[model samples]
Target: MVAEADVSGKEAAALIFTYGTLKRNFSNHPLLQDLILNGDASFIGTYRTVQNYPLVCGPYRVPFLLNIPGSGQSVHGELYSVSTDGLSRMDELEGTSRGHYERLPIKVVPSGEEMEAKITCAEAYYAHGSYAMEMWKKNGKQGLKCYTENETIGYVKRKDRPQHLTFLDHIRLFLSD
Candidate 1:
């Protein structure tokens, strides 16, 4: 069910769990905010993944929630109810069409509790399986349950990155230092 919708009968169609740049105050949050402003989405609340997943940084300090479970920590992030159009917009931005990220159903629970037995089903963008493992390995196999905005290594916005290189190439260059 749509958590919230607009007056014109356009209702949210999906629950999205956001754990990276799309979260509020992050580089790509403007897109999500736009949807919210236009009444195509509504913030549900903060939640933590029901299972552990590798949340790691890759090219340009971009965060990737690797689908490999039971290896990292249960990710903490915000949830949003999104209209079909809003989900499409986010899909494009996340590069789902180009395989940079893939939308997958995940289980989450509201935060600030003692791990409730009840779990909510939501969809989240995870790094594509084709390359997620390799990227995690290249990044020293480290992961975080929550992606802190003030990363110790720093974060780079998309516009600031070199336009000539593909994202995978950027991944290779990310840890050269």
Candidate 2:
């Protein structure tokens, strides 16, 4: 079961649990750095998700958390406290309206030695469809291999692929076809 944190005044900043691109030094980090109160935030819980989902690299070569049941491996990521505006910006970037992802509240545990006693309820951007997995499979096994080998880097730019496909567009097409 998920534990609930005291989210009263002065501690109500929305918590965000990120397991992919939004992590430090990744491509999307710049968008969140200013909004993150703790750059050194702790991991939410164990690296596994409640339901299996593929964590694959999309056509953009960026790592995407696919919401495919029974298809993911144990994954690691960070947690941050973001203001309301920050959440909006993050939603925009994740294409929440366009169905690239869905922002949902999740239960998280503080991994910091000093804060281990607290459990946080946070929101996370989870991949909403199978496009990411399809794109990853189409790219061959190389992308998956690289991601597994190096968990520190969340996004990878593929010089060979054109930037014509936006992440949202890819998902839309996949769902329609």
Candidate 3:
């Protein structure tokens, strides 16, 4: 059987849920805009996860959808349909290989239509499994109903952060900030 990550739109586009920076007008939206302009992705609509999930910010104010199921709020986000190449690019951007994030299945329904709408399972990027729990602890165990960090203290892009520091080092810098 083909691995889930390898299964893509040879025939059908994959559904994706964006809970943080990838949402419209958020920090990382330019990438999605490029995908849309190139016809690699299409916006489905505003959607929210069916179950509660912790949404927190780590170093550089990066939003993390913690993998701890049923622990936070029914987070709202955007949904999209992406072609194979689109999925691949998103996976790369999310750093699945580097363990920055992991793509996992999540159930979402149209925003404001929860009980009346059909639930759809889409793939969403979450905090890396190895550090998710620890990250939550570092964030004072706080959970936001939505990801709106860009308006206050903003996210620093990975490229802009110090190139040589380990993630733990960055975490230290973040705490000091």
lDDT values, one for every candidate: 0.83, 0.55, 0.81
lDDT of 3: 0.81
What are the clashing pairs of model 2? none
Model 3, 1-177: lDDT tens digits are 112222223323578999888998887899999988877777889999999899988887888899888888888999888877788899899888877789999989999994568988888999888778887787777787788754337678878888999665775566556
Model 1, 37-126: lDDT tens digits are 888788888999988899998876789999988878989999998998898899889889887899998999999866765688888999
Residue pairs clashing, model 3? none
| TM-score leaderboard ranking | 1, 3, 2
TM-score of each: 0.89, 0.61, 0.86
Distance from true location, Cα of 21 in model 2, Å: 1.8
Clashing pairs in 1: none
Error of 2 at 169 (Å): 3.6
lDDT of 1: 0.83
Model 2 lDDT tens row, 80-117: 66555556777888878987788776654544333344
